[model samples]
Target: MNLKTAWIWGLVSAVLAAGALAAPAASAETLRICSDPDNLPYSKAEGAEHGLYVDLANLVAQKLGAQPRYVWWLSMNQRKALRNTILAGKCDAYFALPADKDYGTRGMKRTQAFLDVAYAVVAPPSFSFSRLADLKGKRIGVGFASTPQIVLAAQGGYTTVTYRTDAEILAALDKGEIDVAFMWGPAAGYDNLTRYHGRWRVTPVAGEHMDHQVAVAVPAKDAALLARIDAALTELRPQITALADKYGFPQGQPVAVGMAQVQAGPADVALVPTAAGGTPYGQPSPYRMMAVAAADPAAAGRELFNSTCSHCHSPNGASPIRARDLRRLKGKYGDDWLKEAKQTIEEGRPDAGMPTWGGTLKEDQINDILAFFKTIQNN
Candidate 1:
């Protein structure tokens, strides 16, 4: 989501200069963090429940033996808020940034990713299935420009309901207008805990386009601060994870987006469904589904998965690698199993010898592969 437009960018320098020119003397023992004043799960104007970023900032400062101070402002327009506060040096650090250079290339550099978050499928606890096929004609809630909307449109199986924002998506999901909702995980989970009182299950989606890595951002010119922040995040990973969980964020392994995944039938080549808000930014994602392997990609994917991935991740839950068992997915991650599994297949943990098949297999093949895996999940 481009939170700001060209006009907002035009005012950046004036606002930033004002903040810098008005800054007081710095203190070595103070860790200044900039954040939105009213963004729940990230921050709030009332510091009483100082959202995730503030909580994280406090922990980071404590780790550095520094006092934490927040430079709160209206980040309804992130471009203006970030420019005026963080980039202007009114704040030393900014939290909850995408850990990608392209995200905030203007005078800002992101620390190594501290966590990853994604859109999640929110449903009742008794909801049995995970993927689109499992939904089997159920209504799904999605926002404009969201991956779930895109993938569900591609599937054309389940009826796709639309919402303009996360708030609306959650409302539809909570009101039972939609059977399930696909939403940003932090927003969904945080709302689940804070507003809904853990009313629904929030499971993170996987796949390349699904999750975004999050980091603490700092001024690009300040290498020392960047390194220090990165060091602190690494040093305090456990606490950070715990804190993220406390705020209802998805952590560690996440489920893949099975929004388009379904059991094979006569309509092998899926039809693209129209979304309520039209296309995301009016442009189709370069991603396209390839032809399946003729004999039901899921079955093919099953054979392939069992023979290939099964070597590492057993499908029948009989493998020596308990950490890698396919059948025990629900036990480990609830409804996120399919989405998580699809992600693992496409972008394998080469760090652990699982190869990235994204290059080798078409996404449709991978979808069927995940569908096959889904058939075997014990959860």
Candidate 2:
């Protein structure tokens, strides 16, 4: 070959070799994020609308000159999901976690909070609420055993109707069965825009556990990575706000709900008491359950049960839904109740909407949950 052609070929070979060597570094630039697959307004795996968290992850990764990669898992139980995903080293980061210092993060480092999550009052556009007294005599719908239910229970002059999910609460509001629905803000707002076509106004409420800031969580060891993520988040703040708006996240000033009254100890402060003689819902108060949990020998088991099973079984396994109510396990299954419960948990009745835990949860963890169940079963 001619010297000129040989030189050109040599240069091309060198460039190709350099590109091949740099391929690994380019691949390493992927930002692996753990997120809920089906959680709307937060994330979804198979959709054009991939939810706020997914979009934000993409944006942040872009800002950091990295590509976004997702490790999708059902996050019905946040703690369990975190344990199985990010904590298990399946991903580099989790899309979001409560930014509260007291919140159990399982030894994960968190970036500065980028968003506010709260219980919101979802009502018709015509409805206006500036203060807690405005809810007096109003039929407020809340999730069973949710913060809103507990808070409203402590206050007088308001009636609360408990529902299983945010969807149900919003449905009741749409049907006019309730004057207002107090529930998770992002969920209510997303449903209002997507399901109800922006028919209702979702106003965020402030108080104690009522509102919290959310941040991205990374492994505690990933200090440098966490710093980079935080820097990217700050640079992308406007874009993040835009994404929240696109997803219909409730923003602006939150109305001060009467948590002070609840904390101050209301006169009829039987937090989880049955609705008798003008009381509201009959769901078990989480605070009361926490106190009971603290004293129980199976406290670890109780925590596991609440973290893993409570989404379907309800808090403390005291579900009002007959099929899900574990308290009646002994009554319904006779002497073989424990066996039935264990088999059901391990094998999962998919037809009945239960997912198999055998593969995901450790045998010891399952046993602990079963031990806790034994304590709650009513003969």
Q: TM-score of every model?
A: 0.60, 0.67
lDDT of 1 by residue, 1-379 (tens): 1212221322343354458554233232656678777777877757457676777777777666565666777765566777788888898898766665566568888888987777677888788645446666777777643566556655555566656568878887777877988777788888888899897888776765566677888888989989888899998889878888889985535665543353242344443332212111111122333343565766656644543344346553356677676667767777777777778778888798676777656677677676776677665
- Cα shift from native, residue 212, model 2 (Å): 0.4
Which run of 10 residues does model 2 get worst, by summed lDDT?
Answer: 275-284
Query: All candidates' lDDT scores?
Result: 0.66, 0.74
Report the lDDT tens digits of candidate 2 across residue range 292-353. Answer: 33344376577556644665687899999999999998999999998999899899998988
* Segments in model 2 whose C-alpha atoms lie over 4 Å from true places: 1-28, 266-379
Candidate 1 residue 150 Cα shift, in angstroms, is 2.3
